[model samples]
Target: MRKFAMYGKFKAHPGKGEALAEILLEAAEQCKSVEGCDLYIINVSEDDPDTIWVTELWNDLEAHDASLRNEDAIAMIQRAKPLIAGVEPIKLKPLGGKGF
Candidate 1:
């Protein structure tokens, strides 16, 4: 199966950086037990503290898609919506990776 990856950025609303980060962290933890989730890393931008990044690796594109339909993911998205000012997600085709 082909590996799939996603890189996402979340810009927080004013004064909501910490809150947004916490939410992302919680979501990452929730995804830990999810099937096909290879990696779910949460990061905060040094250049822009209010900007958060998440990089997710999955077994395949279908695995990634299925994750979105999970209850934990749905709840996370709803809880995060108000604090997020913007969201950008990019899908990737991984050739090879050390961690993956």
Candidate 2:
């Protein structure tokens, strides 16, 4: 099966950047144990403190979907909704990469 990749950009509510980042970081750690989760990285934008990005690579679409059903992951997502002002997800078809 082909791997799945997603690049997500999150904008935090005014003055809520740090809080949003903390939640995302914790969620990333929790996701590390999920099956088929190849990579889950959290990044903060230096240019815009309120902008956060998550780069994820999964073994397949099923694995990525299953991760969302996790209790901890579900909880984290709910908690983050209030702090997030906006979110955008960009799907990627990774042909080749050093990390892979």
Candidate 3:
């Protein structure tokens, strides 16, 4: 079965990118331990200090759906809630190996 990937881009509070990145790093690690989580990573923008990108790959849709019910998943979102200005989450259905 093909996997699914989620890409998230969020604008955090001014001057709080590093702090938020620290928090997100923990969250990403937390997500990695989840059952269906293939990978989770936090990427910071070089030019923009307030922007961050999160990449998540799930084994399947069921696992991705179940993640919403997991405590750590809930906590991750909650932890990021206060620090974010806006969140844009995009779900991707893998067509092949690479996606631009």
Best by TM-score: 2
Kindly report the root-mean-square deviation of model 3 from the true structure over all alpha carbons. Answer: 2.5
- Candidate 3: clashing pairs of residues: none
- The predicted structure with the larger TM-score, 1 or 3, is 1
lDDT of 1 by residue, 1-100 (tens): 8999989989999878789999989988888888898899999999888999999899999988988888888988999999999999987998895997
lDDT of 2 at 88: 96
The order by descending TM-score is 2, 1, 3
- Give lDDT for model 2: 0.91
Which parts of model 1 have CA positions greater than 4 angstroms off?
none
- Highest-lDDT candidate: 2
Model 2 Cα lDDT, one tens digit per residue, 32-96: 77889888999989899899999999989899999998889889999999999999999987777
- CA lDDT, every model vs. true structure: 0.89, 0.91, 0.82
Candidate 1 vs. true structure, TM-score: 0.93
Per-candidate TM-score against the hidden true structure: 0.93, 0.95, 0.82
lDDT measured at residue 59 in model 1 versus the true structure, 0 to 100: 93
Whole-structure CA lDDT of model 3:
0.82
Ordered from best to worst lDDT, the candidate numbers read 2, 1, 3
